[model samples]
Target: MDFTNLLATEVQTFINQNIDSDINRLLLKRSSFPNVTIQEIVQQIKGRKVAQRKFPFLLNENIIFPPNLNLEQASSQSTAEYKAKDIKGKSFLDLTSGFGIDAFFLSQNFEEVTLVEQNPELIKIVEHNWKTLNRKADFINQNLEEFLESLGQAANDDFRKFDVVYLDPARRDQNNKKKFLLEDLSPNLLEIEEQLHSISDKIIVKLSPLIDISYLVSELQNINEIKIIAVRNEVKELVLIIENKPSTVNQQPTTISCINLESDEPEFSFYINEEKTATSEFSESLDFLYIPNNSMLKAGAFNIISKKFGLKKLHPNTHFYTSEHKLDNFPGRILQVEKIDGKDLKKNDQFNIISKNYPLKPDEIKKKYKLKDGGKRYLIFTQSINGKEILRSV
Candidate 1:
C-alpha cells in the first residue's frame, strides 16, 4: 500500500486529533481524503493507539504500520530492549521479521543487519518505517527457508554468515489458531535447525511461554541456555539460546534463567541438572510466606528455590514456600503471614484473596467466606503438610 497518502500532514493531523475517538463509529463515516480510504485512516489510528503502549518509538510522523495482526504479533518495546542488551555482534540477521520490532532493537549492537520476511507488504512497511527512523538494514522480501537455502551456496556473494541469528516464528497456523510445538510454527524450527546452526554460531529463537522447557531441551540440539522472561508478574516469552560449537562434554547441563523484567525482582538462574538433584523440605505455615514469581513458577524451580533460599515448602504439590525469617533478596513477593481459622474470616471483610492447590478457586473462596475483594490485606487459601490452611497477611 502507498504510504504517501497516510503520511500526509492533513491525514496525520486528523488521526492525531481523533486518537481517542471510537474506531467503529469512525469506520461508519465516509472518507474525507479522496486519496485515502476511511478504513486506511482507521488502520493508522489503531496503529497509533497500539504503539502508545507497545512500541512508543514508532510514534513518528512518517512511520507506517501494517495491519492489526502485525502490530499484535510484534514484541513490546520492553521485551525487545531487554533481549537486545547482551546481544552484540558484527552482523545480525532476523529470520522471521514480522513487524521488525525485535529486529530494530536486536540489531542495535551490530554493524550490519539483515531482515528476511515472507510478507512483502509487511516487509515494505518495516523498510519504510526503518528509513523514517533513520535505521539501516538489508530487508529481504523472501521466505526464510529460501533465504537459508541461499546462504548454503559457498559462491553466493549475496548471502553470508552472521554473528547472531534471531527468529520469532509465527505462532499461529493457517486457520489463525495458536500453535505450541516447534513443528507447527512457520519455517518449522525443527526442519531448519540444522541450517540455522550451520550459518550462525549463536542463534536466538523466541518461543511461546506455554511451550514446555523440558520438551525443548529434549528436542533441540546445541541448547546453551533458556531464558524465561516475564514483564511484572506475567510470563511473556521463553528465549532459547543455541550455541553451535564443539564441546568435550557429552550433554552439558542447560542453564535456565528466570528473568522478571520491569520489576525489582532479581533474576533467578539455575541448571537443569541442579533442579533435578535438588530436594525440598516440607513444613507447615511459617512466619513469612513466599510466592514465586510467574517466570520462576513457569521454570518449575520449586525444589531449587526452596533449597537455595533456605526456605521450606508448604507441601509436596503446593509451590508456596515459608520461612521463620524473611529473605529480602528473594525473587518474589514475601509476605508476613500467619495461619488463621475459618472463624477468623468475618462477613464482608475486604481482602486480596488467593487460592492455590486448594479445593476452591479465588472467587469460590471469597463467596464461601463472604469476603469482598481488593485491599492491602491478603487472604491465602492453600495446602500445607498438615492439611488445608488459611493464611492472613498481618
Candidate 2:
C-alpha cells in the first residue's frame, strides 16, 4: 500500500510504537515499504494534528515544536519565559524569522507582528505552526533585500512602524562553518543599515555565543546593552540591543554584567572602568591573583578588569594577572598560591591541571609532570608577568 493511504491514525500509532526506535534505520531495513519516506513519516505522524505522536516525548506542552522542526533536542526552553517578561501589546517585527521561535515569543508581546522569512519551506512551516496556535501575524515570504525595498517605497503613513525589530541572521556559511561576526554573513550588512535605522526604534540581534563580545561592541554602533545569556549554567546566546537614537549626553563608564541564571543569588555586576582603575605594578610577592571569567576574557577588557580589582596584568594579552589582596566577589576563579615552584611540580604527586589562554594543553603538561587527573586541589597552569610558565592554586 502507498504511504499516503496509511491513515493519520495508523501513522501516529507507528510513530508511538517505534518512538524510541530509529525510524530511519527501520525504514532502511524494511525495503518493502518503498514509498514511505522519512519526510513523509515526519509530516504524517508528528505535530498536533496527530494525537498519538504529537508530544514527541522530548518536548513539554509549552514547547509547541522542536527547534528547526528537527526531532533532535531543542536549543532552549519555550519562548514562554521571554514572552512573559518582555513581549506584550507592542508592534514587533522579526526581520529574520528562522523557524519562527523569536516571532512566536515576540507575538506574545505585540498585538501585531510581521515575520519576514526568505525560505519558502520555513515560511510555510512557520505559517502552519502560527495557525495551529491561532495567533494573528503577517507572514512575509521574501528575501530581506526585496522586503526592505518594498517597505522603503511605501509612504510613511502606509509603512508598518515597529516598536521593536528582531534579527537573527543565518550565522553559518554554505559549508556549515559558524560565522562569528556580523560582517561575515551574506548580502552585506551595509545595505540594511539605513533601512534598519529607519524602520524601528529598538533593535535586538541574537548572536553566536562563541563570538568575542568586545569585537561586537566595537563594530556595532548605537548599542545600548549586551546581554550574555546562560541557561542552566551553559551559555546559550548573546543579545545585543541597539537604540535608534544615540544619547548625546556622555554616559557613565561601560560595565560588564554577568547574569548567572542557575544561581539563586542576585546577578553579578562588575564595573569595567573601576577594574581598570585597580591596575598596579606586578609584584612577585603578591599573595593572590584574580582571573576574570571566560565571558569577560572574551570581552577583552583586561585593563578594565585589572584596575577594577587592583590587580596587575601579567602581560598585555595573557589575560592572567596577579593582585596583592583577595576579593570576595571576583568574577573568575581566585587562585591563592600555596606553592610556586615549577621544579617542585615535576616532583609532586599528581595535579589536576587546567589551561586557558596558555600555551600548553593539559595532557602535554600532565605527561611531562607525570600527574593524574583526580584531585580536590585545583591547579592553574598559566604564564606569569615575565611570560614564563607558572602554576598557581585557588
Candidate 3:
C-alpha cells in the first residue's frame, strides 16, 4: 500500500517485536513478510528506536514519526528544555519550526505559541500529533518571509506583540546538502534580522554547533548570549539570543555558556577573551590526564580552563591536560596515570584505550595491541610536548 505517513497499529506491533533485531539481517530475509514491505517495517522500528530517547511523545498511539533525518536534526528533550529555560514570553512565534518539538516545549512557557512550516506533509503530521498530545498551538503552512510580510500587512495594533520570536532555519541547501552559515540558511536570517527585530525585541536562533562563535557574534547584531548545548559530552546545538539594546554605537561582549546534561551539575561558562589571552604551563610527561568534555572543548576556553584549574598542557596543540595533583571540579573525565610507555604496550593485555593527537587511531591501536574497550585501567597514547609519541596508562 502507498504510504501517507507512518505505519498502522498492526504493522507497528509487529515492528515492536523485532525492533532491536539487526536491520540488515531482516532485509536479507525480507520474503518472510509478504503482506508488508520490509522498508516500511524497518522504518517503523528505526523511527521508534530513535524516539525512545529523543521525543517520547511518539510512543503515543496514532502519533506518526517523521524521517530519521528530521528526527536526528530535531532538538532533543533535554536540549529543548535548556533552550527554553528562563525564556520569558507571553507569546512565542517560531518562524522555521520543523517537526514542532521546540514549539511544543516553547508553548509551555508562553501563553500562545505559533509554529510555521512550509512543508505541507510535515505540518500535517505535526498538527495531528499536536492534537494527539493534547498540546495547543496554531500551525501555519507558509514561508517565513511571507509570514512576516503578513504581519506587516495586517497593520493591526490589536495583534499582540510576541515576547519572543524563535527561528530554527533549514540548515540545508537546494541540493539537500547540509549548510553551516547563517547566510546560507533558508530565509537568510541576516537578511530578515531587521524585520524580525521590528516584530519582536527578543529573538532566539538555533545554529549549528560547528559555527565559529567569534564569526557569529560579528555577523549578527545585538546578540547577548551564545549557548552551546551538549548531551553526554557530545556538543549538539548552538543557540544565539538576540535582544534590543539601547546603544548601537558600542557593542558589549556576548556571554558564552557551555551546558552539558551528562553530569549531575553540567555547566561550564566563560567569555571569549578569557579563552584567547589566558596561558597554560607545559608538562613533559603524564602524571594525571584531564580531557574536557565536548561542551567545554567546543566552548574553546582552553587556556582559561588550564590556568584557572592549575593544570598543564602536554603539547600546545593537544587539548589534553595533565597535573601531578588531583583536581576537583574539573569539567571532564580525570584519569590517573597508571603507566607511561615509550614503545608498544608491554604490560596489561586487557585495558581501555584512548588515543589523542597521535598517528595511530583508536581502532588501529586496539587491533594492533589486541586490547578490549573497557577495563579498570585506561591506556592513553599521545604526542608529548617534545614531539615524541608517548603512551600512558591510568
Among these predictions, the greatest lDDT belongs to 1
Arrange candidates by TM-score, highest first: which order?
A: 1, 3, 2
TM-score of candidate 1 to 2 decimals:
0.97
The global C-alpha lDDT for each of the candidates, from Candidate 1 onward, is 0.91, 0.61, 0.79
By lDDT rank, best first, the candidates go 1, 3, 2
Candidate 3 lDDT tens digits, 66-97: 67777787898778877877786678898887
Candidate 1: worst-modelled 10 consecutive residues by lDDT:
152-161
The residue-by-residue lDDT of candidate 2 on 1-394, one tens digit each, is 1223333455446655664565457655542234555555544334433323322222322223332234221224332244235545468888887766566665675777899988776676667667656778899999988887888888874364678888876667889776776778754454576678788867777777787766765776667666666543456666766776756866554455554454332345554445546454554325676666655554555676655566777666567667667766766667776546667765456666877557779888777777777677766666655555565564
Error in Å for residue 140 of model 3: 0.8
Tell me the TM-score of each prediction against the true structure. 0.97, 0.74, 0.85
Error of 2 at 46 (Å): 11
- lDDT of model 1 at residue 358? 96
Candidate 1: the clashing residue pairs are none
